[model samples]
Target: MSNQDQELLIELQGQIDQLLESHELQDLTSWPTEGELDTLIAVEQGQAFHITLQRDPLPSIPLTVLQSSSVLQIKHMIRLQLEKMEKNKGRHRRISWKYIWRSYCLMFDHTKLSDDNAVVSQLGIKQDSVLRFSRLAHAKGHHRKAWRHR
Candidate 1:
C-alpha cells in the first residue's frame, strides 16, 4: 500500500482499539449488525468513522468500528452490494419456498391426496383448493426446477 493508505489504515485501527477499550460491557449488544455498519459507511461523506458498542444475548460485549478514507469509495461499494442484494431477494425467497415445499412433499407423499390433505389440514389451508394446487405444483415440476432462473 502507498504511504497514504498505510497512514489511513493505522489511524482507523487505533480508533477501533480505543473504541473497544472505552465502551462499557453492557452497551455493546445494542450495536448495529455488520450489514448496517456497511450501509453507514456507504452513506457517509468525506472521511467517516463509527464506533458502535452494544451488549445483549451475551456478556462479553460487541464492538464494531468502520473507518473510510474515501467516502465516495465506501458509498459506491455499499450501493453495489445493496443493488445486488435487492436483485437476489426474490431468488432467495423462491429458494426458501421450494425448500419448504420439498420438505413437506417428502414428509407426506404428494401423489396421495390423503397425505396432502393431512398437511393442508395441519397448515389450515382449505382442503379442496389446497389439494388441487399441490397436485398441480407437483405435476408442473415446480420444486424440481432451480429457484434461480440463471
Candidate 2:
C-alpha cells in the first residue's frame, strides 16, 4: 500500500474508534477493546480499492474504498454500510418469535410453555398471539417499534 492509502486507512480507523466510543456499543464485542489501531488491508483491485476489515471470529467486511477527489466519499461509504446493515437487520427481524421459540424447542428437545415465558419476556413479548405480528412489524422495517417491543 502507498503512503496515502495507509494514511487513509489510519484515518478511517480513527473515525471508527470515535464512532465506537460515542455509540457506547463497544462492550458488545471484544474486538475494539483489544487494540487501538485496527489493522485493515486495502487492496487495489482493477478500478476499485477493496478494503478488508478483520473482525474477531466473525465476518470480514469487504468494502470498495473509493478513490475520489470529492470530500463526500468517506461519508458515502459510511452511509452505504449503515443502510446495508439496516436492511440486513430488517431481514433477521422477520424471524418470528413463534418460529424462534418453536425452533428453540425442537433444537433443545425441551417442552413447556411456561418455562419459555422468560425468553418471550427478554424479547418484551407478553403474549404468544402477537409474536408473529410483532415480527412482521420488525420485518416491515419499523426498527424503532421493534426495539420498543423488546
Candidate 3:
C-alpha cells in the first residue's frame, strides 16, 4: 500500500477503537433484523460502514430503519447508501462534507429537524422519499461589504 493509504488505515483504526468504547453492539431488540455489523461511524476517518447479517435479502424498507431511529441516524444511513452506490460505480466515498436539504421550495432548518431524535412515525417522511442534499451554501453575512462597494 502507498504511504498515504497506510497512514489513513492507521488513523481509521484509532478512531474505531474510540467509538467502540462508547457504543454498544446493536442487537435485534435494538435494531430489528439487525445487520451483522452495527452501522458504525469513524469520525476521524470520515467513514461509515456496516455488514448485513440476516439470512433474508437486504430489505430497502425505509420504515423499518427510520421508525426506530433518530433523524440524525437517518442522515447517516442516507450517506451510507450514497457511499455504497457510488463505490459500486467506482467512485470515491466520504461522509464528512456539509449538506443542505432541498426539494422544490421546502425550507430545511438545519438547527431544527422535523424530528431530530424522534422516530420516523413522528417525522412523517413518506415511503420512498428521496431527500436531495446538495453542498451547503456558504453563509452570506460576511460578503455584504463587497456588495455595498459594488
Per-candidate total of colliding backbone pairs? 9, 0, 1
Q: What does candidate 2's lDDT look like per residue over 50-71, in tens digits?
A: 4443334645444443333122
Give residue 15's error in model 1 in angstroms: 0.6
Give the range where candidate 3 is weakest over 10 consecutive residues by summed lDDT.
Answer: 102-111
**Candidate 3 residue pairs that clash:** 36-53
lDDT tens digits, residue span 2-53, model 3: 9999999999988866555553533223322324243222311333322221
Candidate 3, residue 37: CA error in Å? 10
lDDT of 3: 0.44
Over 1-150, each residue of candidate 1 has an lDDT whose tens digit, in order, gives 899999999999888767756643223324546765554454354223332211133222112223322322322333344455557565332235344344433112234332322322333322112111132245554556556877
lDDT at 105, model 2: 27
CA-lDDT, candidates in order: 0.38, 0.37, 0.44
Please rank every candidate by TM-score, starting with the best: 3, 2, 1
Error of 3 at 106 (Å): 8.7
